[model samples]
Target: MFEQFFPNGMLHYLAGGLLIGAGVSFIFLMTGLVSGTSTFFSSAWSYFSTLPFFRQKSFLESRQWRLAFALGLALGGFAFLLTLGNGQAASTGVQWWRLLAGGALAGFGARMAGGCTSGHGICGLSSLQLPSLAAVITFLTTAIITAHAVQLAGVLP
Candidate 1:
């Protein structure tokens, strides 16, 4: 029983989670920026937008760099899909539409909530802010309820 559950394993996950927490804590301590997923995506979007040449450059113009970047993102996405597919065998599975919808929802939610989960939960908690604590509690509580509701509605089955 222990071997079955621990095959891919728990130690690595615990270590990785600790490292990520430490890194997020360090980021808050040093830069005061939230180590949230939305913040990272926003920063990446900003960086990519500033690089106009990346958009203008054709595949032939910057063949190697373009190919490498595209391949890297594709492989990363593919791996994520594979993991999700394996873990949630009964689900409808990954879809591009779901990605787009999720992105839009996250962007809207981040704006409305005043901060994304990372900004409020990790950074805000690290900074010992009362508002962030409240936000995190509300966010998590709502998430749990919403997840349950969705499952009950057969939206995620």
Candidate 2:
């Protein structure tokens, strides 16, 4: 007894989307901050750690709230995977170095784009910005091309 149009737990996707929307909206409402994890994470190093990167400004300030927000995002994701996902997801069969390389490339891409998926796809789109629209389109197109290329190259399962 399942829905014809929504087979294989389609409701779960809807629920997840609603939760994301609510969470982002709540963050903006309560803190007047966009729920952009990438920026928060990049800025988080200043609060609990010190680095020469601060030389440009020669300043030290606190952004503990950003740290908390980033933590909450991580915890929420882990919780979801642990609970609803039964702590299981498909493996990419990639080695640690490969994963690190992928992450580095993604970070580079985000930097060039001035934001990550969360900033562009979620918050910026919600604000109905044309730049966000373009960014999202580029992100999706790149993802699709990369996925197909990887599959064709037999690099992933």
Candidate 3:
């Protein structure tokens, strides 16, 4: 009964969600910050480091935690992929150029929209902010359209 209910790794997703919620709540309680990953990364980007967009004094001040969280996230994903052993299974098998283009588009979209999906979708939506709702809706709609378009173009397997 329990296995069926949690079959095909449902429990892992629940655990991941619990971990994300706890981490966000902890960061908010400790720093009074919104725990936005895109914001943190923007604060540390080498090219953007000298740019005004990322040079706010307060953003520079809390560099320690932001770097820690960013590195931790990257490390965690790498470790998880190693543990999974079949990480290639997650690939869409699209050409590398197409993947790079998609990533660039996503980055541009995130910047233009003020924040990335996790910022708006997870944190903002959880706080019941209308802006977050709008961002999430837009993100999902674009994602759906993109996916279908790629499939229709015979680019997706």
The lDDT for every candidate, in the order shown, is 0.62, 0.75, 0.78
| lDDT per residue as tens, model 1, 87-109 | 44344565676568867887878
lDDT of 1 at 95: 61
lDDT of 3 at 16: 85
Model 3: per-residue Cα lDDT over 1-157, one tens digit each: 5777665867678888998889788888987878777766566763356777677776677666778888878887787787864564345566898778987887777867877877898899989999989999888998899889988988754
For model 2, how does the per-residue alpha-carbon lDDT over 1-157 read when each residue is reduced to its tens digit?
A: 5577676768778898999999999988897877666655456556556676632241233255667777898789888789987988635667676589868888778756867888899888989999989999998999899878977987754
- Give the range where candidate 2 is weakest over 10 consecutive residues by summed lDDT: 54-63
> Which scores greater on lDDT, model 1 or model 3?
3
Give me the runs in candidate 2 sitting further than 4 Å from their true place. 1-7, 47-62, 81-98
Candidate of highest TM-score: 2
TM-score (C-alpha) between model 3 and the true structure: 0.76
Going through the candidates in the order shown, the clash numbers are: 0, 0, 0
What TM-score, to 2 decimals, does candidate 2 have? 0.77
Task: Write down the RMSD of all candidates, one decimal each.
Answer: 9.1, 4.0, 4.0
Residue-level error in angstroms, candidate 1, position 118: 1.5
Give the Å error, residue 98, model 3. Answer: 2.7
Ranking by lDDT: 3, 2, 1
